[model samples]
Target: MSAARSSGTTRVVILGGAAMGSFCAMSLRDQGFTGPITVVERDPSYARASTALSAAGIRTQFDTPLLVEMSLFGADYLRQTGEIMAFREEGYLVLADAGRAEHRARLAEMQTATGAEVALLDRAELSRRFPHLNTGDLACGTLGTRNEGWFDAWSMLTQARARAREAGVDYLTGEVTGLEAQAGAVTGVVLKDGTTLPCDWCVLAAGAHSAPLVAGLGIELPVVAKKRTAFAFRAPVDPAGLPLTCDVSGFWLRPEGQGFIGGIQPPPERDDHPPEDLEPDHDLLLDLFWPNLAHRVPAMEELRLDRTWAGHYEMNMLDQNAVIGPHDRFGNLVFCTGFSGHGVQHAPAAGRGVAEWIRHGAYRSLDLGPLGWARVRDGQPLSEGMVF
Candidate 1:
């Protein structure tokens, strides 16, 4: 289909319709852009989309000031769930060991500077606050007292999709097979079904599947799929009101329905590139997560495995941070990919930032220059220390 056949306004083609793409379309409308926005998504069910598969936690506790600011805004956006979807403000707890005291303190300073309501608690305070946790080896921990926690990602995406459609955005079910470029700028995209979508701008937010789509255009995004698993279980005792807690060992858990869900990152040597199949490694949960949980929460020693699922994290090789903004050479082609594991929490700010840049030729709300593609192009890595 030609651009005119698709729609009759300033054309914008987004390559994915999950969290990032859906939010981008909504942001464009919210920014007074009455253009023909087409979101091309291969999987509308989003069963395999990162957003739907995520643990769906949002937080303002981050090591970097930019991430802290972005997530702070994201938490605010999520607080509108009463108008979007059901959400929780259960908060997040990030624990630090003795060796990480300095690092945690520095991050706490940055988070405070960004006006995040995060409190640094000593081991005694952590023990007193969450008596179930074993804080003997912990030096300190940061806890978000407000505007943090998990929510229904699919619900948010669904609401955003509906709002975008109501605002004249087009949802196209197709796969972008190739990009059509001229004079070092992307003019449009070609779908696998031989449909051509001409656009004034294109944003790639395809998550793990983004690299192959842009590789043909000579763009190398340092993103790769790394499998992470989540297990839902029933603890022997009720751990109600438990916050999303992260251990210094990388193990984490939080409340889910009547029970709890949690997981631990496999050791570096075992964190291999995930296969096409998203099969959960039950043994990893049994051998790793179970033991870790048992050690942290004595009541969890008798937890019963309810179920498990695996999802991919689009790991950024250079610095494990997001790469946003327009491509240096292809100015018309903007990027909102390589969010690593922060996509769901940072989607709102990122989408708004991208839309603002597209509409006003600069970021009007937040300065996201630190996450621009220029960092990758200039061989400068903006490493984010908080990867969990």
Candidate 2:
């Protein structure tokens, strides 16, 4: 089995039924693949799942052309199912200081050329549009004028699961210990309960937990679980036209109903937090976030800290981009993991790409080769300049 699948798959088993996995199941049905599809998830409630705890923002503000194209497709899909997923087009704004203004302009040029509606705003223009923001120290900003914003991740996950189930994809509750493979081809999935379900094709979309499973099978997947904390707060500023603002001050803030939610990615040295620690990083609010918040938006100085929570970013340390497509050796076993922080938003595109690969032996909609396994194997990282 090569990039073009040798034969049509009969039974497909997907490990980890989160946003990525469930989307694949739904797309499989949409592609008219009438085989037996099974999704194995450790938790049916998705209590600790990344999809359930994410900020659920979607955007077309990627640096890579392939990624920009991928997110554009996802934004379209989410818009078609807008009401179902509570999708909002509030847009995203990323700021750049004097030093990086030139680079930001270059990125905007690249994005706009890829058909993304990006508006590169100077400091004057940025201040005019979002007066509440403290753009005194900023040189420029890029705003996604259309096809960007937030959505309810829980709704997207549950709805996709329900619809995929209704379309005859079996949902199984179990923890997959490892892949059962022989002669470089995945044959079945071994559960913790000692049950082995055979599969003609396997999709390993285990998210942040994908590393260990493939390690046991002699594969290297650099995806890891990194902790990120988001805080909800109430401020006096109106949420009238505030986009999901990524200030020059290291934190991203968005309008979440009557209040707002914001967070910052910890520096690499201090981000080695265990996945099991779901406790809120209240210290961030006191030290980094609070100061930055008040500095970026002057009115936020009078804000009240409502609450805080944490979630694991399924990080691809090597590139910070997604690791998609099949394993170089195990062609029947495709992967849809390692989306870092944008998995939920990009799930629709990833799923459609993977499903098309499994059914038609090649990608029909988006050519997902740029994010494939070969890049990972060769250690050739196609890094994204702006991933927030």
**TM of each candidate vs. truth:** 0.95, 0.97
Q: Supply the TM-score for candidate 2.
A: 0.97
For residue 322, model 2's alpha carbon misses the true position, in angstroms, by 0.6
> Per-residue CA lDDT of candidate 2, range 1-388, in tens?
5433323448899999999999999999998888889999999888878899999988788878888888798788888886887778889999999998998888889889998999999999988888898888899999998888898899889889989999989999999999888887888899999999998889989888988888878898999998889999899998866789887767989999898999987766778877567777778787888789898888999988888888888899899999888887899989899999888988989999999988888888889999999989999998975655
Instruction: Report the number of the highest-lDDT candidate.
Output: 2
Query: Which residue pairs does candidate 1 place in steric collision?
Result: none
In angstroms, how far off is 108's CA in candidate 1? Answer: 1.1
Q: Report the number of the highest-TM-score candidate.
A: 2
Q: Which segments of model 2 are wrong by more than 4 Å?
A: 2-9
User: What are the Cα lDDT values of the candidates?
Assistant: 0.85, 0.87
lDDT of 1 at 371: 94
lDDT of 1: 0.85
Give per-residue lDDT, candidate 1, residue 332: 78
